[model samples]
Target: MPRANEPGRTVSSRLWDLLFAFDPNNTELTLADLVRRTGMPHATARRLTLELVEAGALERTSDNRFAIGLPLWRLGTLAPRAETLRRAAQPFVEDLYTALRQHVQLAVLQGDQAVIIERLSAVNAVGLTSQIGGQLPLHCSGVGKVLLSHSTPAFIDDVLAGRLRRFTPRTIVDPAELRGQLASCRSTGTVVVKEELSEGAESVATRIVDGRGKVVAALSVVVAAGSIKLQAAVPSLVASGLGLSRSLGWRPGIPIRTS
Candidate 1:
């Protein structure tokens, strides 16, 4: 049965509904889950899902659940912003990973969340709650804090007034404490977070800016909590971030020195 008083939706809207049903927390879905999420009639839901599967927009798992397919992922890489940023940032990200031998990540702010655009993983790195295409919180993540430091005051206020999930005990929840942290990050252009998002993980991150001084991205290195000193990693992470920013036309201090 169609949902009670469900707004009349077009085919394009329905397609968007099905495609967007897959998110960070809901990556794979059973038919019932899709039907429930989309609130479509069972027959219409199954038909559209099958169409998506046949069109290679989505794939069926071994357990008969559906997930975003390789074809869609390939298509997503062609998006101008994501692909270009991935290309421009890969070398710096690689250098950071090689220097630190830990999990290195590149992220960009998408609305209030930091979207992981790319990552380099080490075999024995600490366990992570996030992966490529995953979202990070604005309060507790190093990259998230860096991005938040540059965000508009309105955005920061809105996020602070909403839910601030505490993944670990160190996660920043107090708005006043977080305000001070943001101020410090804005001044230093970097943040070192200790197990704020995930237990057993720590990160040091800095901002990547463009010619206009607009922070376009964030770079970070994730290492095991207490395995090595955060100070040891901060220099390299900051240098790599500045190098990447310079490549994108950000000049730190002094006026327009040869870009």
Candidate 2:
């Protein structure tokens, strides 16, 4: 177990780690797995896990396993940044999905990861590993790159200093190359990712601005790699992003800067 006064140590933080350990790929966990993953004693893990279950943060399965509960997912809907923005952007996102018949996604920066707040899927669009509430790395994903490009200078430097995991052969790991790409995104108001995160998925993303012209979120359309022209998708993506931004009180006169 971590010491109480250790840097960034807290009961709530540990609790969150326990919660995040559950994912779509690993929805069920045994007590021993929880204990090992959290590095907490079996007794402590059981007690805390029981507490989370009582609080409706985790659900107990018929087989005695634990998974993330719907209550926690509902609580995430209450986040103002997500609730308000997603609600306002839903119609526009839907329209874009209808027009393009592709995977439309809305994302925002949460720490160093891009969290998918909302997504509209076409019946036969390119398959994506990401889902609602799933996270994507900031260096290789379309929405991630757009969100990171608009982040603070310190944050940019910190992300560059950290490990830049290569998801595919085309993933950009060089800081200088990524810096140039971000600069181009800042000027063009869009980021086109070609098979960076997934082997055969491509995404075109644009930044959504708020009333103050701050890039609050990113909107993207994922398509099959090399099948669709990225430039052809830019206009629709930009229009949808701007429409959502306008719904958030962004005006045309304000200059929207990217990175």
Candidate 3:
């Protein structure tokens, strides 16, 4: 709840407030919205917002609203967590997309959510709400299930105990049922989700590991719900996941069924 003009806050702190004001839900903001959210004086907020724009950190849209700019996006890509995994998995993502002509995505576990790092899609792939840097729910999404399967037991218990949102009728809300699914996913290294995240999308996801055999990320191929493509896509999805894992120094000898 702190703002730029607080008695002891620095200019850098103020700048960060402006930067953090934008998120997935609040992608664009007017000058008034910025002032209110950052709790800065009108003139001060306008001044800082304009400075961010000039510095290529914020962009002005056609409607005169502001959004995170391209330069900020470029800088964010340098973040160690996303950069390392993305750089290693991008090629395999593209190859999977090429072979299946579906949408291929790479995601990493972030807190209770799965954050998508890279996505490759064909011109006519099934519509997806997720984009690069966007988040997917852990309970019902393909990548989400894979990442959740590898998370700590306590974390999984906390997640299942919380209010699980239902995106569709197919979304599994029973903790016992979901626990069973998670167990199967952890054992098989792959899962098939049917319209759990969206109405018409199905995702086949698998785990990606590092040399240490630690699960580092998840990869998925998304296609139309009930597409005949599921079976064909599974092998390639698993291979691509394994290939990217090996690139990170993971060995085939390491079993994926580990807790």
Candidate 4:
């Protein structure tokens, strides 16, 4: 593999390295920070960062830091998968939020992780680590489990072969046990998680399918542990997921496809 500052590296690759340095946790960074994070020379980092700012892909902040700019954000919103799913799931998500007054989220599988495409949360709902565009671990989170349950066997095997982080004591790190849970989730189209990802958060999730019966996304509602009956939330969550699926052309007779 080429080093970060290898002479043969392309300008676009360097620019991408700088941009990819900014993530959910480190959303803002100074020029020096970018240089350190990208392992690029100070001059190279500064030049590319300035070019990005000039191109409206990044913006400088009052404190001399940089953040993702509106133009780049607008470009991300144009992603067909997330945008279309969000639009189709909006009404159902809103209804679920109003009916349950909890944290509702819609997520899609991106590689081995579940990326939240849309989310609605009540002011007093349980605290959560994920936000829109944030990711969740497939073995531990409710939405992650639902998405993982419908994934291809090879993909599932690969994910299981990787290291599974134990976020909490309740998180299922044993591949065999987790695999059994996934099998049940695949059969039922829903899974209830209790403080598996976060200490005080519990979630109920269901799969969302599309016209070809492909499992495209997962819809979930998160609440404080033991605050409300997890089972009670299932009906509404599953209904909302099914409703969103129907809007995307899924029907009763269509067999669910795993990708």
lDDT of 1 by residue, 1-259 (tens): 4442267777767776889888889989999999888878888888888999998899999999999999988899897657888898989999988887888988888888899998999888887868888888878899999888888888888989999988888888999999999889887888889888888888999988887888878899999998765778899998998888888877766232111
Task: State the lDDT of candidate 2 residue by residue for 1-259, as single tens digits.
Answer: 5542345677788687788677778899998988777777677678889999999999989999998888987997889988888899889998998888889999999999999999999878887767988999999999999999988888899999999999899999999999999888877779999998999899999999988888999999988898845667789989989888888889988887544
Q: Across residues 29-68, which tens digit of lDDT does each residue of candidate 4 receive?
A: 9998899988999999999999999999999889989999
lDDT of 1: 0.85
Better-scoring candidate (TM-score), 1 or 4: 4
Model 1, stretches more than 4 Å misplaced? 1-5, 23-33, 51-56, 59-67, 253-259
Against the true structure, candidate 2 reaches a TM-score of 0.88
The residue pairs that clash in candidate 3, if any, are: none
> Cα lDDT of all candidates, in order?
0.85, 0.87, 0.89, 0.92
| Predicted structure 2: lDDT | 0.87
**Which segments of candidate 3 are over 4 A away from where they belong?**
1-17, 23-28, 36-41, 50-56, 59-65, 69-71, 255-259
Error of 1 at 25 (Å): 7.2
For each candidate, what TM-score against the reference? 0.86, 0.88, 0.86, 0.95
Q: After superposition, how far is residue 172 of candidate 2 from its true place, in Å?
A: 2.1
Which candidate comes out best when scored by lDDT? 4
Extract clashing residue pairs from model 4.
none
Taking the candidates one at a time, how many backbone clashes does each contain? 0, 0, 0, 0
